[model samples]
Target: MARTYSLNTEAAKEANNGGKRINETGKYSGKIIAAFYEKNQKGTESVNIMFVSESGQECGPLNLYTHNSSGEELAGYKMLNALMACAKVQGLTWQDTPIDLYDYDEQKVVTKTKECAVELQGKRIGLVLQQEEYQKNNGDIGQRMVIAAPFEADTELMAVEILSRISQPQALGNYMAFIAKNPVRRLKNSQASQPAPRQAENPDPYDDDIPF
Candidate 1:
C-alpha cells in the first residue's frame, strides 16, 4: 500500500485547545511578541518574554529569572543558551563573554542586548509548553507558566508568519484572557494518550522542556 501523509488541521486544532497553534505536547511555533522585566514583591527580578502564536494567541510570558537578590544564577544560563541558539538561527552575532541578565533589562547595549531585543521581537521560535498545577491570582488551581524553548529543526512550523501582522491587539488580548480563564490540563504523551493524575497542592514550576 502506498503511504499517505497529510497535515491534520482538525486534530491540530483540537490539540491546541482553541489557543495558540501548538503540537500535541503543546509545542508552539511563533515569535516573541513582548518582552519585559518584572520584579516580584520579594525583590527577585526576572524577565518575561511573551510569544504569540501565528494565529495571534498569546502562548506565554516565559519567565527567565536571571538572579535573586543575592546575585545568583537561577535558570538564567538555560535561557541564555536558548537565546544564543535563536541568534545562530537568525545569523546574528553573539559575544562569548558572560551573559548579563541586567543587559536584557535595558533597551541599549546595541550589539548584545539591543540586537537580542530586535531579533526576538517578531522573530520566529519554537516554544515548548510544560503544564503544572498552581494557584491562580484568584485562588484557583489554574495558573501555570508555559515555558518555551529555542528553535530547532524539528520544531513544528504553524502559523508560519508573525501574529502581529495578522491579528488585532484586542483579538490577541481576548485570546490570552480565554487562556487565563481556562486551566491548562496536563497532556498525555503521543503514544499513550492516557490522562495524568492531578496534584492536590501547588508545587515548584515543572522543568520538563526538552534539553537544548
Candidate 2:
C-alpha cells in the first residue's frame, strides 16, 4: 500500500546522517503516537506511552531503546507512532470505520489490542496497534508505566503485515520461559561466589559447664 506520509528527504538525511531506516522513511512532521510493552522477570506485563512526535522522521526500530533501570525496549512504539503521524499528514481517514480492537489467535490463543483506521484517497485501511503505553503519575510521588500490543487485525492484509513485522508467539513465549528459568541459576551462582560469614569472635557467654 502507498503510504500517506512521505519521509522528508532533507529532514531524514539530517536525522540519520544520510542513511534512513524503513520506518523513518514514512515519518514526517506530525503527532506520532507510540506505545510500549514491558515484561518483567515474573512474566508480568506493563504498558507505557513512549513518545509523541514533534518533528522530523520517526525513530523507527532504533527508537526502541532499552531503559537502564527497567531494561524494557521501546522500538515498537516508535514505529507505530511514525506510521500514524504519516497517515495524519497524508489526510487519510477510515471509511469502513475500523474497530478499536480486533481479535487474533496465536497457536489457538486469542488476543487483541488497539487499532488505527484511516481512508486514503477513498480506500479504507487500518493499522493494528502492535503496541501502546498508558502513563500514570502519583502526587509528588512517582510515575508508572504500562505497555500493550495488538495481536490481531480485521483484514487479512493487515494481519499478514503484522505477522511479518512482529515476533511470533511461540518464539516470544520460549524466550520468556528461558529468562524465568535462568534467574534461579544466577541466584545460586551469586550465593556460591560470596564469602562465608565470619565466625563469632566470642563464644556464648551463657556456657556454665566449664571444666575446672
State the lDDT of candidate 1 residue by residue for 1-212, as single tens digits. Answer: 99898998866775656644332335456676645555688777675666666565665456778778877778654454454344333223322322223244575433323123444555666665655455556865553655533443233321211111222223223333444444354333334233432212211112232222
Candidate 2, RMSD to the unseen true structure:
24.5
Off by over 4 Å in 1: 1-25, 89-116, 137-140, 153-212
**Tens-digit per-residue lDDT, 77-154, candidate 2:** 333333332232222232332222213434442333422223222222222212212222442322121111111222
Which candidate comes out best when scored by TM-score?
Answer: 1
**What is the alpha-carbon lDDT of model 1 when measured against the actual structure?**
0.46
Q: Point to the candidate with the largest lDDT.
A: 1
lDDT of each: 0.46, 0.29
